[model samples]
Target: MKKLLFTSLLLVSSTEAFAKDITVTLEVPSMDCATCPITVEKALERVKGVKEVDVTFENKLAVVIFDDEVTSPDALTKATENAGFPSRIKS
Candidate 1:
């Protein structure tokens, strides 16, 4: 019984250590036209750990899903800036 309890506790802790997916919405004021969204999406996708990118041209927003362990929000913002579309976290 003690062995089984220990195994379960280890499993739970191990799972918690694993990376988690996080979604961040960024506002890109520079997204002025239809083509701008495409560029922003491509930029975000290039970042490491980025799992998905959805850019809404009409709303000038980019929603990115990425692994927290491999990347961060700063990296996401830098990627967009490098692509000529500076962005910030949506309030």
Candidate 2:
């Protein structure tokens, strides 16, 4: 029973790790002020599966790691818009 439980746990963790981390650079045209990135970062943090998020205020970019099963880039973009920083995926 212990072996079976350990195997199950290992499989689950491996599956979670297999989920690819996608990074997106966003064109935040509305980020005209210094505080915009802070708000955007905070808003993105509210999303369900974002493992990490880094915003570049000067370059207008955000690199994010998220679980594909739990969220998507389109959803992230929408969240950015709702946060008052309208953004579009780069490439």
Candidate 3:
């Protein structure tokens, strides 16, 4: 019984550690036109581990959900930057 309990706890802990997801909003002030949002979304999607991307052109904000274990907020920002739309985390 003790062995089974220990194994179960280890499995649960490892699963939790491996499945971390993070969401962040970034302010993109450089988007000049309506089509910029599509460009921004494609850039972010190319980044590894990026699960979802939503860009609001009027608000000039990007909301992204990614796997924390595979990517960071910095990487997300860099992706946008590489696409010619530099951004920063929204306060």
Candidate 4:
């Protein structure tokens, strides 16, 4: 029983170890209107594993927090692009 419990704990920890939260800033130069930020925000929020999304029309920047184990920065960019606002990783 002790060995089984230990193995279960190890497996749980190992799975959780792969889940990493990452925050990235994307520059969306095409957001030119007041409603653009809203659109961008909604698009990013639809991506799986995206924890949070903040888009600013004034600066044309989208800040996104997501789980690396489930998604990636490339997927984030693609989401915005599909929403009609192409974006790139902020340098």
Candidate 5:
């Protein structure tokens, strides 16, 4: 019984190893001020599985790295939008 429990725990933890980390660049065209990047970055950081976020007001871009199994690009965009800065995936 102990061995079976240990195997189950290992299997559950190993699922995360199969999750891919994806990096996405989003264009936040409405960020017209320096503080805009701060807000955008904060919003992204609040998202689950978000590993990193880099927002630049000068380029109006947000680079995000997150676990694909926990979140998605669409969810990232929605986060910025909810913060009042709408964004889209860069082409």
Candidate 6:
């Protein structure tokens, strides 16, 4: 009975879907004034599977959460750069 229960639990747990750890925090060198967040948010929003985006003008940082299955951190960075702002991954 224990073996059966364990097997069932394993299968159920394995079948459940979970969010991936695909968060990226980066600094935008070109972000100087107020409109920076708007630009960053709009650029990131166009990407598929991007669930959240937070941009800090004061700190010049952008943190994004995206689905790995749909997009990648590299792609996210590229998108930000293309939006007329240069960015680097925060260490």
lDDT of each: 0.94, 0.85, 0.96, 0.95, 0.96, 0.86
List residue ranges in candidate 3 displaced over 4 A.
Answer: 1-13
lDDT over C-alpha atoms for residue 52 of model 3: 93
Judged by lDDT, which candidate is best? 5
**Which of candidates 3 and 4 is the stronger one according to TM-score?**
4
Runs in model 1 with CA error above 4 Å?
1-17
CA RMSD (A), model 5: 1.9
Q: What residue runs in model 2 are displaced by over 4 Å at the alpha carbon?
A: 6-10
Cα miss at 20, model 4 (Å)? Answer: 0.7
Model 1 / residue 25 / CA error / Å: 0.3
Please give each candidate's TM-score: 0.82, 0.82, 0.83, 0.91, 0.86, 0.76
Greater-TM-score candidate between 1 and 4: 4
**What are the runs in model 4 whose C-alpha is more than 4 Å off?**
none
lDDT value, residue 1 of candidate 3: 100
Question: In model 5, how large is the Cα lDDT of residue 72?
Answer: 96
**Which lDDT tens digits does candidate 4 get at residues 1-91?**
9999999999999999988899999999999999999988999999999999989888899999999998999999999999999999999
Ranking of predictions according to TM-score: 4, 5, 3, 2, 1, 6
lDDT of 3 by residue, 1-91 (tens): 9999999999999988888889999999999999999999999999999999999999999999999988999999999999999999998
Model 6 C-alpha lDDT per residue in residues 1-91, reported as the tens digit of each score? 9999999998878755554648889888898789887998899889898999999899888999888878887888888889988788888
TM-score of 4: 0.91
Residue 27 of model 6 has an lDDT of 86
Error of 4 at 24 (Å): 0.7
Give the C-alpha miss distance for residue 57 in model 4, angstroms.
Answer: 1.3
